[model samples]
Target: MVPDGLALPDDLEGSRNCGLVALSVVARCSYAEAVRAYTDVFRSAYQRHPRKNWKGGTTWSLVVKAMASLGVQHSHTEVTSAVTLQRLAQFTRRDALYLVCTTGHAQVVKNGWVIDQRGAVPVEQHWGRRKRVTAFHAIKED
Candidate 1:
């Protein structure tokens, strides 16, 4: 399962790489590995050297590139303005990790919880009131 061996950092107090952190856990690898993969994807796809702090933060485009580099297939769906816990539970699957995004943040949802650098918490608690879910990335097996 995706949750197996997945662990979060003790404190992401000052980190701006929530997307990378979530991707690392979902990819089951180290944060450095995730940064390397993101950089590789950026270089290969854009044909330019990524900024030194490219991996320090994330954007929607970067997330897509990272997912592609990690061999995870993804899709975008227009969700309603309000995504309740029940809807989230029904939208997610057990074997896959769901990369969810709101207005300014991204998180990994697995097994009814939000898996981020801080830790795994219920989706309702971490999700807050910003409910503009723009995309969903489903991790694929090797």
Candidate 2:
């Protein structure tokens, strides 16, 4: 039997049926949502991946060029190299967590968030309840 909350049609055909179509649509929507949630993180890391920005228009090419650029006469090739695509990728991935944490929207915390019936401001618990102030009494000293 078809369960509630599902839009499966009873008259579904063979493998190429409406149920399958609905299932695919639901799956795609779910996948899209997951992708959207993670895209920012991916973008943050992808931008810095060394491979993404190597000279000669490619990281590998840049590495090769750098290796060859040094005159053969040099006794020892520069053990170090410029930022490669791999390095860039590593850099971005390392920073992605911090970037996302620092870049996202601000979350306001009230004693309690309040919304009016019309969804207007000053909703219940908007600002914590205002307390009354009482005066202190002091006895007169001789």
Candidate 3:
């Protein structure tokens, strides 16, 4: 399961904030809270709301720092392109949690399901099935 209430809230409108949405779902926080956490990392408070004035770019380093701010234990890794989103599930332990980043998007994968802007879906059926995994993080579940 994708975890209860992990889906992006309807109010989020879900655009240009893939990293923020993924962070919100993984940390089980409100979309507003995620925005706060993310902007706090780089002191970009002026553009707190993605829909309003978000700059629309989050690097892997920013994700790491933001996760830390939220007290979400995580570790980052760079992987080969051979590890497509589908292949990622194959190598992932069934009990592990991950925030998989592709060329320009992110998703939360756990227990063989992926939760993103569109809600939860099996890894194979995910919209980014063939998206090459650029980098990924192992999120320690509490």
Which has the greatest TM-score? 3
lDDT of 1 by residue, 57-122 (tens): 677777678867776666665565666433665667775667777666777777766766667776
Task: Give Cα distance to truth, residue 109, candidate 1, Å.
Answer: 0.8
CA lDDT, every prediction?
0.65, 0.22, 0.78
Answer with 1 or 3, whichever has the higher TM-score.
Answer: 3
Best by lDDT: 3
Error of 2 at 11 (Å): 21
TM for candidate 3 is 0.82
| lDDT of the structure predicted as candidate 3 | 0.78
Candidate 2 residue pairs in backbone clash: 48-88, 49-88, 49-89, 50-85, 50-88, 50-89, 51-85
RMSD of each: 3.9, 27.5, 4.2
Q: Is candidate 1 or candidate 2 better by TM-score?
A: 1
Give the higher-lDDT candidate: 2 or 3: 3
Poorly placed runs, candidate 1 (over 4 Å)? 1-5, 9-16, 44-55, 73-86, 127-130
lDDT of 2 by residue, 13-64 (tens): 3432221222222222232332232333334446867465312111222212
